[model samples]
Target: MDFQLTDDQRALKAGVRELLAARFGRERLRAAVDEGPRLDRALWRELGEAGFFALRLPEAEGGVGLGLPEAVLAFEEAGRVLLPGPLIATHLAAGVVDGAATGETVVTAVDGGGLVEWLAEADVVRGEATGAEPLRSVDPLTPLHRVPVSGGAGLADVRPMGSTGALPTAPLTSLFTAAEQLGTAARACETAVQHARTREQFGQPIGAFQAVKHLCAQMLVRVELARAAVYAAAVTADPVDIAAARLLADEAAVRGARDCLQVHGGMGFTWESDVHLCLKRAWTRTQRTGSATESEELLAADLVSGVGR
Candidate 1:
């Protein structure tokens, strides 16, 4: 089947990209990272006004009534710009909130699968009241706190991670995260290619070297492969398909960042370079909804068993 993006999809991508380029530029992203775990309230409000957070909700719910595919396009652009914050959680919570359509409310995810501690930033937190527990997150951008719940029949309680089964939201969130990674990977590839073409060494362009060419080609392959899987998952909306998408996307993110760094050589390792930032974000996001290994194992099991359900 043809997998080309429709005209509307292309328009959506272009719109989001332009918005991000204007509002969430590289300087703003670096400032947010430097400032610690706090989100850019002004940027968030701007995004809200632009309907970035309310794209998935129904029109009656005060949203633009866009579907997941559109959400994926917007999120892909967000990833390319390394837009920080718990974007997926915020958007998902917005869908569940009462007056989120008009961008009147804010929402965040509850840690430990407990009572979602809708912080000062959130007008409401969506989750079971008892499932809340206080927890700290490694990524400063995603503020972490507890959700207090008595107990439940699931995984560990100390740092109760939300299972894909316990919270049906995991799959969708994972897919969105994957889509973001795909975007990042693609951008990273572009950065690497551009650098190789411009950076001269030994009286020749670095891109002319066999090693650099191979790296760039490999990055392209990873990005395209991941894009295919992500697009398939976005179109199908099947949990199993999402498993594969997550695997490919995570691989692309991880490898693309590394390859881009390699192409940039020493410069890629510096703080000023955006490659490391992309790498860090990719590493953090890969572990968000679930581990890459877990996703791979799940996909492998399904393939081996010929499971089509």
Candidate 2:
């Protein structure tokens, strides 16, 4: 089968990228960081107006009438900029919560266990919410609160977003999460290469160094491989496919960021540099929806006995 993106898909990706570049520039991101973890109502509304949070909702529901592939591209842009907040949760909350599609209401989620993000600030929550308190998050861009489980379920106040039975959301989460990882990984590679080209050592550009070349090449390889898996998962959106995609993406984002930091040498770790933020965000994303271990386990189960369903 042809792997090329259709014209519309390419347009969607470009549009999202342009929108993010215009809406969430580096200075704005730093400003947002200074303000801390509260929701950015203006940015959120801009996303809504842009049909970002409602990409997958049926047009009948006043959404964009797009599918997972489109949603993945949009989320890839968000990831590239490291846009904060409960993006996936709010997008998934579209139909279940009135005004969520329009960004008029803010929603957060309690994932299967004690992991609930933005619980304190959400206008509405979905899942079983119970004892909730803020937990310091590694990615300051993402404000999170973990809710203690009660009777085997975590705390959330909104009704379960199921008509009769809940639709499986793992694949959606995994695909979108992987897309985010792909974006971050690409950014890390770009940042490292750009720095290597300009930052000179002993009168020669650092990029001319054999070691730096290898590092940048490896970063590109990881980013491309992860992009392939993420795009494939966006196409299929199968659980096993998503699991595999998430696994590759987790490694690409986390490892790519670390490698980028190494290329930037001492300055990468400073607060003024975005390199550290990428690493932290990648680390944070590795545990969301499914981590490396979780994804590996799922893929292994499916490979060994076709057990994961």
Candidate 3:
């Protein structure tokens, strides 16, 4: 089957890409990092106005009436730029939570009803949340808080998503997570290639070195392979397919960022460098949406059961 994106899909992805590039590029990202964990309300509102949170929500429920594939395309840009806050949570909460469709209210949910991001800032909470306790995060863009479900403190507004309950949730969320990972992997590869060409060592660009060339090449390969899996998962929306995609995507993103860091040498580890941010984000996201090991187990189970055959 052909994997090419439709023209409208390409245009939609481009529009989101251009918007994110302008709003959350390196400079803006660095600024936000320095500003700490505060949400950029203006940017959030602009993204909401642009139909980001509502992309996959039904039109009857005050959304744009698109599909998961469109949502995946939009979120790829979010990951590419390393946009902060509880993005996936808010998107999932769009029609369920008040004002999430318009970005007026920031929403958050516990991953497995345990680890919560931006808990205090969330105007609406979901997923058997009890109350949050402060926690530090590795990614400066995404701070952490743990929300235990002992008392089920915030379940009042946490409505179920129709008859699907939570069954259809994982694969859908994994699809976008994999898309985001693909974006980060692609960006990391690009960043490494750019640095390789421009940064000189021994009176010659490092890209001229065989090892550096190989590193860039490997990064590119991982990104391309992960991209294929993510795109296919988006199309299929199969749990096993999404699990496989997540596994490939998590590795590509985390490894690609590390390889990019290697290409940049000492500068890559510094707090000021964008490479570290991507690396940290990759690490955090791996934990957020079913880690590599988790995805592997899911795929293994499917294979053992011969479900996809």
lDDT of each: 0.75, 0.82, 0.82
lDDT of 3 by residue, 1-309 (tens): 768889989999999999998898889999999889899989999999999998877777778888767888887888898889888888887877789989998988777535778877778767755566777888887888777657534322344454222434545666777888889998999999999999999999999999999999999898888888888877777878888888888889999999999999999988888999989999888876566777888888888896668
Question: Worst lDDT window (10 residues) for model 3?
Answer: 155-164
Runs of candidate 2 exceeding 4 Å displacement = 151-167, 306-309
Indicate the residue-level lDDT of 229 in model 1: 86
Q: What lDDT does model 3 reach?
A: 0.82
lDDT of 3 at 32: 91
Instruction: Give the distance in Å from residue 178's predicted Cα in candidate 1 to where it truly belongs.
Output: 0.5
Where model 1 places Cα greater than 4 Å from the true spot, the runs are: 99-104, 111-167
1 or 3: which has the higher lDDT? 3
lDDT of 2 at 135: 78
Give me the runs in candidate 3 sitting further than 4 Å from their true place.
Answer: 149-160, 163-167
| Clash-forming residue pairs, model 3 | none
Clashes of each: 13, 6, 0
